[model samples]
Target: MDNSQTSILRRTVSSDTYKRLCSLWQQMAERKGQDSILLTEETLFSVNPSLAEKKYRERFCLLFSPEFRALLIGTLRTEDLLYQISIIWDTRTIADFVDRLSEESGQRTEIQCLRDRLQQILIAQPSNNPDLQCHFTLKLLDILTPETLGGLEQMYPRVSICKPVEDALRQQVTQERLLNQVITQIRQSLELPVILETAVKEVRSFLQVDRLVIYQFINESSAENERNHSSQSLGRVTYESRASDRIPSILNLTAEDDCFTYIPRYTEKYRRGLVVAIEDVEKAYSSSFCLVELLRQRDVKAKLIAPIVVEEKLWGLLIAHQCFETRQWFESEKNFLGQIGEHLAVAIYQAQLYAEVQQQKNTFEQRVIERTQELRDTLLAAQSAHQSKNEFLGNMSHELRTPLTSVIGLSGTLLHWSDRGSALSLAKQRQYIQMIQDSGKQLLELINEILDFAQLEAGKVLLNTKEFSLQNLSRQVLKNLQTEATNQQIHLELDCRVEPRHDRFYADPDRLQQILFHLLKNAIKFTPADGTVILRVWKENNYAVFQVEDTGIGISEDQLPLLFEKFQQLEKSRQRTHGGTGLGLALTKQLVELHRGTIEVESTVGKGSLFTVRLPNQSHRQLKTTPASKVEERVTFESKSIVLIERDEEVATLMCELLTAATYQVVWLIDSTTAIGQIELLCPSLAIVDRNIPDVYHISKTLKKLQTTKSIKILLLSDKITSTDWQSLSRKGIDDYLLKPIQPHLLLQRVSALVSSDQNSENDKMKL
Candidate 1:
């Protein structure tokens, strides 16, 4: 223990390395009940060595000094040699003793001393993989100095080999074999149960765990009808494994006591691909007695759960348990479970896709059968219509000649009487004029019927859908037919059962009026004097129903089916009582179909006939309506403003009055030149503009671009808007469009709806 022994140690090892090693050797020597021959730096620098500066230097060299660490590795030469010497001592014990000595003496100990120098070298190598490095090092050392180990044994025969290093080598080999088997199983098949069962059995056998299972959180129910009622109670014990006679099976159990209820809490823990390991369930879930009790029932003293994620959703669980006794779960086991869950999710997804494809195939076959029957029925109807068309042409030729001959003869007699200056009674001349007028009207009616039938046949009509008052439209049609109804001595009456507000619906109003007019006119023409014609309208579900009943000469059952056919009339003679071509009802039927509506007629042989029309209350382009009672009253909207820009004086005056009555402050601009200034000045919630107004699109663009007026809804009014014009108007951001001659009540309803809808949307954004 003098300077002579120090010189011997310094000659064998580096001076700095020997100093650090001496601190380590002394700790071991003390534990062995012997005195250390080496001196420590703490004892040498013992003058207030506990000062912060000296302590920092010691920690710095221990953790980060490359030069000092290099000297230690060079001195020990191999981690194997360091391990052999440590058995004559102990690395953990020496480390503990050095820390205690430093605390007691108030100085830095040799904390960085490489007592396990072989392990240190292996850790510093790339990947920190010691098995490959240890194997190669052992081979090289045996070849270079086979007798070196023999010399060490003679000095210290009690040296023990490191058990952990050997154990790690065996585990690595087992994991590699298991991983290769699993990957091959996954690649072989996509069946759900097969993939999951293989994973559970193989992973359990490799990890040497008592039990393993894949517990899934079932989001969908096996019974689809029960899904909405109670999906929370559903989960399956999908797959399971156990050691020989180690524990009872819990597979396929859907008992109420199942742990599926804990999925919500566990999902948060493992949603981000985390692994959870519970060494002891009692200790882990001490605050949650229910969770602990759930495990205890299954004799699970320890457990681990890993999440299976598919498409970024928590799909299910992969669980492992120690049934007989508490066991600690390792990082490697958790990682392997996660990999298995991922592969199983892929297999399950593929199975689901296959089931969907099979369902779609079945649905497609059923649709084909239904469509084929419809085509067959249509072909038969077409054959019957071919015969009726031939008869129509011959009857139409004679019908045309009679009207033409009357017009020519009556007009020539009047011209001859006037040119010859002959005495002719005023009453006779007047009668001749009346005959000419009636013939001309008959001729025009025939021509119009043909044109309408042709247009319907060629599919040339397009519906201009808009919200309009059905009650108001029907009244207008009846008013126009008053003269004809009076001359025919037929009484007209309206029986409206629809709510006043509900009577306003979306459809092609012009076309609807035309259908009503034709049906009413036909009723009056067939009905005798003192006969009554009644029009009834109501709403049921999403359809507006209209029925026109007349006390007329009713149709027979045999001829009723042919009533709507082209040119097929009950009286098919040239001198028929109807005195016209029989295309009216056919054209009316086609027009009803164009509006996605149906018309049907029921008649008794002599009592009366009832014609009913059902049209959808809403169109795709129509805004959804809330019930009238739910709407906020128009009187409460006195602060809102509207701008009316119409070149037509009468229409502008009418629109302004309607808007004003609805509690909107209206600014009426008759001239197109001043419309932009008026609309901007008013800053209205809505602007009603005539489509014919000069520079209307430019005005809409300007108003839309400005910050203050950008949100103002623009409703374009056009007398005849084509399909292309509608598209152009939509691009300019027109909110709603009204055809010219729109009813006053309909205009008010539309404006109120648009403004209210805009206000509601803005409120939603503010809430967000």
Candidate 2:
């Protein structure tokens, strides 16, 4: 292979070159008669002189063919070409050719005589080729040199023995390419199944095994498990590649493996990064009948098992099998298969992480979508309410002015007439006074309605309870509404569907009376002149049911929801027929609720409307306890609510479970971007934020800046914390810090402490 040792064999063989060489040979053969410079049958026979001429002449004649000559020339030495002399001829041919020549005479004289004859043959060629003859003679001398022949023999002592060198070298290159291809797939693909499938098929072909499989565990992988970790009862085959139908698939195969539990060396080796190559399972596992029998059943004569461990858990195994016969596994193959398993474990971990991240992403997206819809609905409601307020503003001005105008005008007219010293009829005076009194009463009623609604909204309203008779209450409400109903020509009826004794139940007499009077008045107002209005009172489930049903200009279903909202009215009629504000039903609902009661309404657009009021018809003593509801009705600080802004599922799950067990209301936010909005919405007692949040500082600062959220307690969680981090955190309005790797009891204690406290000091910090 060095410059001095290698011959400069310049191959000038082309179509044209072949033609010239063929013509030269033809001329030589014509002159020499069956003998030429090129190889001939007789020349080969001389080298193997002992051969039976008739029998081997045909075989020897093959060397003179163009195909053989081309193959021989292809083996010649060159810088770039591989010296593959073994492909055409081995040492036996060379030894025989050299040995036959030496048998005739002295070796030197024989070689010299042959070289001179070849030189004379080239020199005697009749052609205008002076330079060629000299160059040819020099190459002829070099070829006949003893040292060059010795060098060739030494460099390639025996071609037959070294034939596998080329194959082994090619195998190395192929193996490298195969491994790179598998790694590339892992890198490029997010689809775990596709990567695993392609890897197994390619690996099986590379290892030239009957089958390859990824034996993944159905049960969670653990190094501690003796029964499940064993080969005989190992995990299920998740992916497999088979050489042919002749090879049996071990997919879903299960066998009893009690012996594996007793002898755990196999699994132990796998954990230590060692491949368990079973050359002959039948022989090696003869002691374990279960393992041997299982292998036999699966047509496994040989096997290579490598563990796919991820994050120190024995996730599964990469297994290869030889089904036909027992195999002698090479060390290199064992190492490569183990390496594949390691790489596959990496892929599995990556894929699992990708799946988790995607799940988190999808969950966040869904939450965002749902929250967006909720916000949109809220915004619409707020806009609607704002529009109603504007309408009320205009309506209130008109409503107040009419009564004031009447009152002022009547009084002013009376005073003017008196001051003018004019005597008018007493009838006119009484009518003017009456008109002023009526207008004053109307203005007072509107002011009282607004004042009551304001008091209810401020949570200042308290019920003055009494056992009022439902019968009397119904009669009074009907009587109060009789004149109004009569003016509209609408019939008024009272249906008290209760025993007189049972009707005397617990309630505020005045508020209860007000509740009924409002319902009946509303019914009478909306009714057409000939329509009917009824006040129906009954007792059911120890509760009073006061239903005011009317055959009136009914309310549409869409407006029914708005009917109980403040400043809401049946606008279709507010401008034309009905008067006053939109607070009647809203105020009634509030008062009903204050007395531990409910109000429900059912209405048809064109037929009628029914408003049902249910109040607990019990005495004051009855409110001390209730039998059906086991839970207490009183509010306490234990009702403390928290907003958790942590994205890690494992950590969140632990924290949420603990807090919930401790009876705290927890709202989890996987999407950190919504942290501030959620805090503002819920206005929770505490917001537990993970420091991992990129905008944790900004979130806390934002919460502190908002008036509604300023008082909220903030608990910052981190995996690690130094003294230096606290200053920044404290400046950002982080009231407290708790380090992560969350401890259940400690996490609950910290959360409870934060939620219970009305405020947090900057120095309050807890570590792992």
Candidate 3:
């Protein structure tokens, strides 16, 4: 029935007139074996003889008013509970019909119930079909006494007139009960797979469809190892349902078939939570030939798909298919499946969170195990290093005291000899003086080695690269060491096999000298009397190689690796001939590595040892040879001002003397904290500031930004230059950086260059 008619009939079940008429109509319809049962005025009066008395027409009119007839007409539809209901109204009604009914004592109860029921009918005012004029059979029924209906009964009257309405109500109740049960089960299901499986089965049976399946879209996030392994999109049949006589199941069909092509379409719809329903797959997706073929193969004529959304992301799909024949999906079925997808999304989201938490737990446990092992290894290494350091310190104490004792004794003896000049020989006095000098030199060399090793360990060493003749540097090194070689009774020889093109290589000449000196001195110390030591230089590819070979007591295979270790000595005997602080070779390795080079040792015990040093033949951009004239010919700047911002009193005084000697106006600010004000006032051509000065970074930044000092050239001085410090100062417009213990000539040259560059820039701007 249409909604309006069904609502009206349902509402009338509580009406007295509707109840009385339904009883009479059912009785007559059963007797005639038909649905139509009309009650006319003549038949109604025969049933109730009191209606033929005074003002009977008026009485009928009161019970069958136009308002009542309109309500009945609006209620009765072609699909209504009642097939037909008519009321032929009598126009002769007078105003005494209600009074006549009131006067009947036996009918008063019936009339009062009718009056109350009619008053409670909540029909809309002025019905849409107000022109209807019908005689009310309800009026006669209202006037008839219950005793008269029992006395004039023809056969037994039917008592089941409201069966159609009852049946409709029952069906609605059943549908609601089933839906509630399904919803409760889904909510209570904790396992995601189980929930989805149950939902598909329930929905399939409830809809009586041929088949239903949940086609889940397994995207990268949902699939483990998808990103690391495969690039193809995938779909899996997570849940499926079927009838016993239905088409073959398409469950777990994830092969690279036609279904794979539909992933893009499914993903788009799932992202937007869109629903797709097809009455006939072939007709709706005709252009999707593969999809059509796949469905036909499965004997699926109709289909429905919905999205399962979890946390605003498309997780998967909920699909239903009708395989037996072409089936049109109803709105109600679509709504049911959509609801299932939503609940499933919640379950799946919870499952994914649980999985992620477990994964994190596993990862955290594995990291903890690895970290524990690392900490154990680090503890063992620290203990070993501590023991080695203690042993080295003990050895160092002995080494230092031995030289100091000799110097002290020899000097005291010389002092005593001079006091007793006549008692001591002239030759003996000269020998005592020579012994003192030798002991002092040995102590000084040991102290220097220790300091160099300390600096290397502390990462305080900086390279001073410059262009120099490698060939010339080697010759100078050999010449300086010739006396030492003679004293050791060893033959020292030079083998220069380097290419002419590589002879003039660029590097830190002084550091390179120290490295070569350590290697050659160690070789001479270990060589036997009359043993030969060779210093070899050659060019190979991009490297300039130097090898120091000695025919001496060579190292054992087990001790080769330990040769370059700090404070390590091969000879542990108390009567060993060779003596050293054991820091020379370690410092050599460090120096070589600082120049982006490597040092390797090759030795056979009781034969000889060969130490090879390979340094990259690279040229620095700021390379310059120390010209003999530049060192002596001092440049004078009579009026050009220079600011020296140094915190050290001695260094500042030394620089002040140097600048004044060169005829340059100098402003020495010991308190660097307020140097900027003096700097602005003097507006010097160049400012040399110590990098360690307090607030140096702030000072540099301010000086670069200040208008008064915008053109002032800045030079930074530090004990060691790190890459970070260099870049930071450079970004602040510092013109140059100079390492501490600065060479007088190099410092002056850098200052002159910076001031000259500033002048050139200003001149260029003026010309522009």
> lDDT for every model?
0.66, 0.69, 0.67
> For each candidate, what TM-score against the reference?
0.43, 0.58, 0.52
TM-score, prediction 2? 0.58
Error of 3 at 200 (Å): 5.7
Best-fitting candidate, measured by lDDT? 2
Residue 231 in model 1: shift from native, Å?
A: 13
Q: Comparing candidate 1 with candidate 2, which one achieves the higher TM-score?
A: 2
Model 3 C-alpha lDDT per residue in residues 606-638, reported as the tens digit of each score? 788999998875435312332323212111122
Q: Sort all candidates by TM-score, best to worst.
A: 2, 3, 1
* Model 1: lDDT to the true structure: 0.66
For residues 1-768, write the lDDT of model 1, one tens digit per residue. 122221111112223433444444344334334212233343435535445345322211121111111111123424333321111112233344445545645444343243234235334531212333233223322322325435544665553433443354345446655665666665676566777788889888887878888777674422321322343545668789998675878887553423334444445456577888888888977876676777788888888888877766677778888887888776667766776777677777776787778777876786788678778877876776676777678778877999899999988888888899894799998898888898898888788879878876775666666788878988898898888888888899998888886877888788888899889988988898999999998999768998999999999999888889787878856447765577878888887876657899999977889999988654332223322331122211222667788777668877877777776778777777777766655556788888888788988888899865788889889876767888888888787888767787778788988889766765575456
Full-model lDDT, candidate 3? 0.67
Task: Specify the highest-TM-score model's number.
Answer: 2
Which of the two, 1 or 3, has more lDDT? Answer: 3
Q: Which is superior by lDDT, 2 or 3?
A: 2
